[model samples]
Target: MHPTDSRSLAGNVAQLEAGRQITVAREDGFEALKALLPPPSRRALVLIDPSYEIKSDYAKVTACLRDCLQRFATGTYAVWYPVIPRPEAHDLPRRLKTLANQSGKPWLHATLAIGQAPDRTTPGEPAPRPGLLASGMFVFNPPHTLKAALAPALVQMEAILGRGRGQGHQLEAGG
Candidate 1:
């Protein structure tokens, strides 16, 4: 619930819902996360869903996950990223995998594509193109039953959406 933009609006909305449960911080989520980690936390589910407005967000996400792992090796971490043509989006899953490997923990990656693949003619094009074709979530220290639970659901969603060519769901996991 740590939203960096439109701080007052976000904080107000959070307060209306569950003021005590949600701490709406007007700061970078990575920094907020750092302050909340380590000694005090016994077990945690850290979800890092940053707006990739800047390419540096990708690297920051990776770096934050790496540092978090060092502090809380057993914490369950989930990262959500768009599935676009950008190199950062494409490489995120691999980077997350590398982090999971370093910690010797299992991770699960799931992607859902609601439409056809985006055009890639322009290699250096900026992201957040006209259409949002796909999105993905990478989960470190995933629950054992997550894959089995998500597979059929994603398949059903793809079928319902009438997925186009090269448009479908993907689930991958490893230790």
Candidate 2:
């Protein structure tokens, strides 16, 4: 009973169980992802990587996300933005907040930075590794069960990705 015909960005149709879903579209970009959902309700998850530099794109992403939130009965939004060496990273949460506020729904938001400690010394290092210190997944409207499912994986990814003192961390819901 599952819909196994859906494709992904790589053009592979998944073989999932009944009620399982998969989508692969490039025309509309992320909007295509949102369009795959059937009306009425279901949990929603959004993951943005390497946060787009364009404010307009970010606004669109948040708008589409807000629309999904309002349309769904109960869903969580997970937006992943890189902890780049810049000030804009700090402004993303606020921008998302503004987007949600405009939507008039109380959406939870969190930020996590995955990369080396900015204060670490690199005197003799050939060059600082370009990767996350501790990649994080920020969730808004997260399900109660998500924490348990992700906790272990985060630890593992952090340990593998962290340089010196890698610690894949979760900021938790409402933190």
Candidate 3:
């Protein structure tokens, strides 16, 4: 299921070819998320990939995760975030760690930095370098076999990208 706030995107999704079982909703994703939660959802994979244009999105994501866990603690949530030079982006992983600690749920934080961040000498000037410097995913209640399966894949990705200086993955288990 995909819920988008943009009407154009919603229209595009609706125009997709047949045989697609996608439930597309043109509404605020955070608000739409609650309605999608099944009462007896034993196992689920919730992917939260929001455009962090506004700082409030970070807080909303945290709140949504908290509520989702309260309703379905066994569900696995994968939050994808861009690795940018912003306070919210920098603090997301830490916030996720706090949430996992509070719930006593094991989580995994994996980051892939394709290249070094731009060298910004000026304080106010925007970082000029581009081409996806970094990206990360925080997985809550990860599968038991996830780490073993992803370890070698991450290594291969790092080798393929040719940027081993800071590109790597980390897994943290909750008690």
Candidate 4:
């Protein structure tokens, strides 16, 4: 799992009870991830944290996803980015939509958000500023039962992240 924040990664490790066999990549460099996995692990779940703010870097991500899809059963990709006021962020989901629409295999995507943006300053040492608050996922060849599992998990994740900032929607290929 690739996470931008140490706090979030630590929380996930504890909540998921990831075993001792797990390897934690404290740095953001993805090469470590590729090297850790075998040449053809087949399927995987990829999480891209808010670190991918530069759209140009998406080329590497897109290529990696394509290669994984061709060689694996399915690829689950989770992308997290702040809801910035620009087309770049919005365009990302659109491009992913185009990929799913053109692909023959089963696919799914979803967008999640917390509450509205929060003011920069507040009383009592200031509340944690609500981030632009957006996340998205693309699942290739997703299992039919994914909705049931993903929905509840997301709800719980939102709660742990904070309050009043829970919202999400899913898109499926050929739906």
Highest lDDT against the true fold, candidate: 1
Per-residue alpha-carbon lDDT of model 2 for 52-99, expressed as tens digits?
566565566666676666666355566776655555555666766665
Segments of candidate 1 deviating more than 4 angstroms: 1-22, 39-41, 117-130
RMSD of 3: 5.0
The better candidate by TM-score, 1 or 4, is 1
The candidate with the higher TM-score, 1 or 3, is 1
| Candidate 2 error regions (>4 Å) | 1-12, 15-20, 37-55, 97-114, 117-129, 132-134, 165-170
* Candidate 1: clashing pairs of residues: none
Q: After superposing candidate 3 on the true structure, give the runs of residues whose Cα lies further than 4 Å from its correct spot.
A: 1-22, 39-41, 117-129, 163-175
Against the true structure, candidate 1 has what lDDT? 0.84
Clashes of each: 0, 8, 0, 2
Query: How well does each candidate superpose onto the true structure, as a TM-score?
Result: 0.79, 0.61, 0.76, 0.59
In angstroms, what RMSD does candidate 1 have relative to the true structure? 5.5
A best-first ranking of the candidates according to their lDDT comes to 1, 3, 4, 2
lDDT of 3 by residue, 1-175 (tens): 3434566666776788841544556567788778777545365788898888889998999999998888788888999998888999999989998999899999988887766543656888777655667888899999988878877887778778745445655445553
lDDT of 4 by residue, 35-143 (tens): 6444355545666553565676555555555554455435565555445566676676666556655656566666566655445665778577555666677665667
What TM-score quantifies how close candidate 3 is to the native fold? Answer: 0.76
